[model samples]
Target: MPRLPIIHKTQLVASSRLFQVEEVHLEFSNGEQRIFERLVSRGYGAVLIVPMLDNETVLLIREYSAGTERYELGLPKGKVEPGEDLFEAANREIMEEVGHGAHHIQLLKRVSLAPGYMGHHTNLLLARDLYPATQPGDEPEPLEVVPWKLNRLDELIAGNECTEGRSLLALYMVRDLFMRLNR
Candidate 1:
């Protein structure tokens, strides 16, 4: 493995919020030269969770995304604000999107949404012990609250119900958590 830093960055192209981009040439003291690679960069996102009372149901949200121009069934998520910690962002997004607060937040995974063509990183959080709170702020109207049964988790996966890769990964982690809890 090599520690590569961005020598220079430039946006080669931008279309529909996805940038076909590039960075300047890279060089090492050992005299190795290579062009810096740039992928579609969305930076970062969060996965929010709410465990139902019996600890059997997980709260999910269905909301419309302008970028995709379609409704996506996913766990609550949002971009991280400047200089914000990932967990803080996750907590804030959960409250804002679902009006819920989580007591136990375990980071299940960190995923690269498109290692081939995107510089996006989605943080997966396993949140438990939830309580109601006033909604954080305005988002798309008519946010649908879906109670996802732990046993039926695969239904969503099998149905290909979720479009966000981050949400899918989060649910997969929750499934793993469920297996651990059942033991």
Candidate 2:
């Protein structure tokens, strides 16, 4: 294996209410040096939940994304609050975003979104045995709950609305897990 680069220095370059950008200087083993900017992570990361409405249906939410400036269909997710476990965060997010709480929740995987630049990590969870519930969320507007057929994920990905990579990845992971369990 190649040796990891040595981070010689790090400096904060920018800051906002939600994000902090930092510049890191690294020296490679081959006498190469480079400086890179990354969005530093805060808090206990996040959780993205794939809520199964039934064996074939999955619940998604259509929420307006500030980054994209439009409503995007994606799985329910939120940052893990201080002192909250990953399962607690997943259940809370599903209730807030999809109006349901899961009786069964399992951690599927931990994933990163653009590891080359961002330090954020998200835990993908599979939630099943849902019951009707709701909790106040920080969303500016009510999220539109969208029920999608798991078998037709290809169609969902083909559309322009479901563009969030993390959500899409979670959906696929859940589908694969369901298939394995049934087999």
Candidate 3:
């Protein structure tokens, strides 16, 4: 079997609100070459959290995703506004999507989504000690908010119930943090 080609160079093809698609040219170790073989771009996003309320419950949101064409359960998340810092974006999204603001916010992690093919990255945030704040004047789209305990968190993660990418990452990271604290 022939070895796959490696990308030797990339050039910007086009850019949009969230990302820039690039065309990559590649050369195989065995001397084969290809042009414009890959499309890549970065998307900006924020991940918000509803931390354990009283050591047991977590706030979650359920809604239908047009992109996935499925009803999904996850925490509040959305694209970062232009020129917005990731942490600020997370806080803004949480309030907009979940109707609660984070009193304490910690950036848990920053990761790339499918770096091999895409340029999208997400910031995972752990927010705790939430309280009711002023709601957005424009009505938020329909969402179902529910609280679940730590025991049930695994069930949500295992069952593919939390389909939102950033939400799942944040949840898993928080779960790991909790496990470490208990030890």
Top candidate on lDDT is 2
Estimated TM-score per prediction? 0.76, 0.97, 0.76
The digit string of per-residue lDDT tens for model 2 on 34-135 reads: 999999999999999999999889999998888889888898998999989999999999999999999999999999999999999999999999999999
Which ranking of candidates, highest lDDT first? 2, 3, 1
Candidate 2 yields a Cα-based lDDT of: 0.93
- Write candidate 3's Cα lDDT for 119-175 as tens digits: 566667777788765356243466777787765766886787676667766767777
Model 1 scores a TM of 0.76
Candidate 1's clash total is 0
* Model 1: per-residue Cα lDDT over 1-183, one tens digit each: 566543544546435564566655656555677675666565455445544535688888889888888888888877787777877777777778777777777777778776755677777787777778656466848688788887887788788557776677677777777788888
C-alpha RMSD of each candidate structure in angstroms: 3.8, 1.0, 4.1
Taken over the whole model, the C-alpha lDDT of each candidate is: 0.70, 0.93, 0.71
Residue pairs in steric clash, candidate 3? Answer: 41-119, 42-119
Model 3 residue 58 CA deviation in Å:
1.9
Misplaced by over 4 Å in model 3 are 1-20, 27-45, 48-50, 137-140
Per-prediction backbone clash count: 0, 0, 2
